[model samples]
Target chain A: MKMRMLLVAAAAILYSSSSLLMAEADGKWLARVPDEDKARVNPLAGQAKAAAAGKIIFEENCARCHGVDANGLHNRPSLRSERVRHATDGQLAWMLRNGNPYKGMPPWNSLPEQQRWQVITYLRTLPPAGAAGGKP
Target chain B: MFASPAFARVLSWAAVFLLPVPLLRAQEKPYFVTYSTDLEEPGNLEIALKGLTASPKDANAFFSPTMELEYGATAWWTTEVYAQGQATDNDSTVFTGFRFENRFRPLPREYFVTPVLYVEYESVSRADKSILEVTGHDGISSFQVNNSQSHPIVEHSLESKLILSSNFKGWNVSENFIAEKNLSNEPWEFGYSLGAARPLTLVASSQRCTFCLQNFDAGAELYGGLGTRYSFGLAQTSQYAGPVFDFRTPAGVTYSFSPQFGLNDNSIGTLWRFKISYEVQQIRDLFKSPSKRNAQ
Candidate 1:
């Protein structure tokens, strides 16, 4: 009886700890950024209005697959980490204009330039990976 | 004795003049007059002609304003007469000949293969006569005595065609393989086609152009045209020659137009052609619903 109780207690602890670890892993994965070899910009600084407009544009186009809050979806990379934080606005602009064809992303150069900039601005506001309820 | 360049030029001109006038007359019809290049096999006109030549019972089986008559006396068939006076004045041509057709079944029907055949013959009368002839008694005498007299020469032909067709889920697919001999005196030519079609936008009063793979002999065809009211289509044949345009107006009539343009080699001028057609209502009704008549 004693041994059985001990085994049950150990199993419960193991299950809880594993659940916590899985939650942490999910957050990290969702917050991981793309394109690490780029400079960073504070999207919140002088372009708050642009970023606000960008949020709307991003939701209209990118959010369908990228997730509502810019958090990554299944197989899509997050924008919270060093890679996204360090990317230059121009680089993001380029990616938005001419999408990665090989990656099945369609070019949005046909869209207005202001709209492209707005998407870039919105991408900058996503919280980093481990924040509560910030990522999947 | 040698013929000088001057003499040769005169002879050539003489030959061209001496050649039958009816040959040019036959080709003088307006470009819009429909002409199917498939002369070896019985074309729609030929089939109608055959029906007309048959007994009155066969005549009842066919009804068309344009009529033709053909007859074969022996194992070899002879004579093809086409008459269309509705759009012209006293214009018709008769092609008399003996044709030999031998069909060979190399594969089973399950394989989608059918019997193939070869036909060779000499077309006679004005239309079949050569465009050029030899001049002078000496040249004429040589031509008369020579077994290979080029004038009124034999036009040889051999054709192999296989047709496979099937229908699935309201869509139809037809494939055709054809090979011809003596293309402009060249060795032989071959072509194949696969066509698929399906109807879209089913409505009581909707006009939709059916999509097909081989509509214009191309791989894919989408039928929709200006204002979503008209149905227009562009297709490419399997040979990838070029796109052929087909259109239908809101009147529920169908038409096909092939635009051809090239440089006239002799005149160094522009050569252009625009063909248009309107199917007779009787024929159109037979193929489609008359309530949905559209323009071509």
Candidate 2:
């Protein structure tokens, strides 16, 4: 039994090492977001408190890939890029809820709806476009 | 493949020596006995060290320490391997055994209630006392046997669980129905566990703080065993209810504790548990999180 278990563990380790990471998709994923999700408005719109709360959430959950400044990191798309600045709240929410897992982002569905919205609100507070982030 | 048993052991132990990982799970789950629909994110590995101190009124108290390596096989599948050892007060200490477990999520998206499938294989002995769960007429009296005298009965078992979980607003509730069978002659045994938890506050503070209310999650869990196939009920079984709490730091570490009280005479008097976990980004060569992967 011990040997069999060892075999299983070893196989799992081998599989992980060889597993393929997220491959970049054609940047046209925006079209995949349903129209309804695109039209939805942010409930926490214009609330500084909500945006402030979201800043923390983004730091905790997103800074690794998105960069602490929310700019592009390595090949990761910047949350502060022109695309994100122009996206509707619903679109951003849709992206967070259903991550482009095929492209490497795991779904943030584990996060609560309120927190997701707070993050959206925080993103709204960032600079218009092509900026580092909201902070000075 | 490994050339020999010693090499395999070395490889397994070597995985532990390599460190540096963040626990994405700590932010989502606060219960020790029950599982939620939250699977490990793809390309992430979480390492957890948990210790259990079980106190039985009529038997010597024992402390069981467990090391778990949980890996995200994919977004829909998570696998874990556990090694455990037990040390008894005024008695001998023994290597309990190892458990391999996997959980699969069927649905790609979150719904009102999500269902996950769980299966595990345990290679252990009668002297093992991890008490990860209570199953099939398990009683406290059986735990009083001396470890030296009980280690010979090596029991191999397969256990499966139907995990139903949900997340609404900010709270997570989960229920698991368990069934187990011994490879030898034992009949099918049943068990169950339920858990519910939420962060102290759904809102996060703009500033990073270790002691913030948002960093803490509190919940409760109830678990117990049913009887064997011929006698399938809660009678002559062990049941426990406990309060669970966990604190997540800004540095990608989580600390969790639970104190469980036995509900019936068949159960142990008390059980205390503490766990610390960290996750390691697993996807490399192709992609890596912006951590210190270049050093590796």
The numbered model that scores best in DockQ is: 2
Tens digits of per-residue lDDT for model 1 on A1-136? 9559847854453344223222211222212224541243433334676667666556544653356655654334465656666657766665664444223233454344555666676677667666764663
- Candidate 2: count the clashes: 4
Residue B245 miss distance in model 1 (angstroms): 27
Q: Distance (Å) between predicted and true CA of B37, model 1?
A: 39
Stretch of 10 with least lDDT, candidate 1 chain A: A21-30
Candidate 1 chain B: worst 10 consecutive residues by lDDT? B50-59
Separate DockQ for every predicted complex = 0.01, 0.34
Residue B71 displacement in candidate 1 (angstroms): 56
Runs off by more than 4 Å, candidate 1: A1-45, B1-296
lDDT by residue (tens digit), candidate 2, B1-296: 23344334433554564354544434558888788878876666788877787768889877777888887766677889999877776676678788999987776555678788999999888888888877899889878999888887888999999999877777889999999999998899999999999888877776667799888889999999988899999999999999999998877788899999999989998899888887765443234344633321
lDDT of 2 at B102: 90
